[model samples]
Target: MADYLNNNAGMDWDDAIENDGQEFIILPEGDYNFTVTDFERGRFPGSAKMSPCNKATLTLQVKTEDGIASIRTDLILNRVVEFRISAFFRCIGQKKHGERLVMDWNKVVGSRGRAHFKPRTYTDRDGNERQANDVDRFYDYDEKNFPAEDDWMEITGDADDLPFN
Candidate 1:
């Protein structure tokens, strides 16, 4: 495998690929490249403070000769304060295709923290209204009227994409 390191010694990654089996690979701290494949439109369930600005980029590549592939994701932890965040990709259909990347965050306040999700609303060009999805909820968080410092935040979803068989 090629050394997954950048010129600056930062860990580089691609997030758009997936392996056959379930496994986790720890990555060193650094900047990485990612692409957006699919995402879930609901609040990520966990102990990380989440903002509408939170987004994940996935990068994918495949080794034609060996049939090997490499993938990575960069989780930009851009919260107002220190907090814990957890995320994973859950496939929706039984065919084991179409995955939903779910993330959860818990706000860290001094010593205590609170669980929160993005506020949601719906609007139609012709005047129709509808409920927002998880992605929409995150977008709403990005667009703020008052624009509080804490309002605009982001986090990177960086991980190694392990390919199966």
Candidate 2:
């Protein structure tokens, strides 16, 4: 965080916050048992330049040989991408094949399943090469293959639980 601030001192403090040395695992490209830890509706830049759009953002916690790793995926809710949204629901044990879209997305949280990841390379604004483990696909989970709750990533803290100043 300090290094970033040093490199761009003109940047706004709000735009450049600290990572706080948080430890995270960058999972290798592969499939693993995962749980839906968080789900939310988020606004993101659309393909049309500055145009914004809403999407269902999912944070999956995958248990791997290294440790529990966090993987994020977005499902566009637009009519054109309904298939993607259905696929996401199927992976999370919600809707089945040929099933209509009629379920609470909130119920998706805490659901466990298999997630497939693939390594993708992209150039950042700084023209530096970076690699990301992106979700390639998701597999339906069998109850027998489910990991114990303890095996999944745990959220240790919440801002609401913190003492106020």
Candidate 3:
């Protein structure tokens, strides 16, 4: 089993678990802080399924970037818990006739030169790190499906969690 802890001012809790049917921790719309620990578990089955926990710290901050739009979160991870991170975003609008939504890192800045990033890290029951490069390729959206400004952008990928701390 895995144990999660949230240590923030006024946060009177100590441990949590995402497995066994508990996946997410709900937080109200405001400025808050949290810490996740003892995530050292084996990966589970299924592509979209949750993996085992590794010793790490995940901090989420919800705030507006420029006062125009609300940037839901700023995730900061400490320690390389897993090889990948995945999430879904709400698609708000439709794409143009031939435009497509592609993961172009060049379009955005300050992403460590990672263009079209994808999740490609996995660990087995033996706790061995496995490299999964080809498995991280994007397949859903094509170049001809350009999304509108209001459309939601789903970003999924892997990163060197060691550098975060």
Candidate 4:
């Protein structure tokens, strides 16, 4: 973080506040198990396809041989994307197919699921190109997809019981 503030404070890549090394993890486009590490409730303004509605932004963390990759996905609470909402829930075991259930955002974090992530290239508003991973599809949770005991990623630090300050 210090390096980012010191050297890379501006748009110039040559400048860096500090030399904080960066690791780029490029996940292949395929099926992978992921855990919901974060969730946020947000609102979306009306768009051409639908009216303004509540949105669930989820941060999914996938463990791989290289490292951990974080991908964010937004579930728009609108009829146009209703199937996506249902699919996400089903993938995380929060809901079953052919069933109606309330979206319990409280239990989202720490939940594991399966998804197909693919690389995406998009031009930013500034016309600069950017590379990112997008959730191409969500697969229903299955026993075969569950990670083995040795596959779990160990996160450093111990703040499990502490409340956010």
Better candidate number, 1 or 3, judged by TM-score: 1
What clash pairs does model 2 have? none
Q: Write the residue-wise lDDT of candidate 2 on 124-162 in tens digits.
A: 999999876688887764566674555543456887885
Which 10-residue window in model 2 sums to the lowest lDDT?
1-10
Q: After superposition, how far is residue 54 of candidate 3 from its true place, in Å?
A: 9.8
Looking at model 1, how many pairs of residues clash? Answer: 39
For each candidate, give its TM-score against the true structure.
Answer: 0.19, 0.70, 0.17, 0.77
**What C-alpha lDDT does candidate 1 achieve relative to the native structure?**
0.28
Ranking by lDDT: 4, 2, 1, 3
Total backbone collisions for each predicted model: 39, 0, 11, 7
lDDT score for residue 35 of model 2? 73
Per-residue error (Å), model 1, residue 86? 20
Over 4 Å off, model 4 = 1-22, 148-150, 153-165
lDDT of 2: 0.73
lDDT of 1 by residue, 1-165 (tens): 122323225334864543375232222222222112222223323355545454443333212234322343334445642122222221111112243323432211111111122223578887886432122111111122223343212433544533431
lDDT of each: 0.28, 0.73, 0.26, 0.83
Global CA lDDT computed for model 4? 0.83
Rank the models by TM-score, top first: 4, 2, 1, 3
Backbone clash pairs for candidate 4 read 3-18, 6-16, 6-17, 7-15, 7-16, 7-17, 8-16
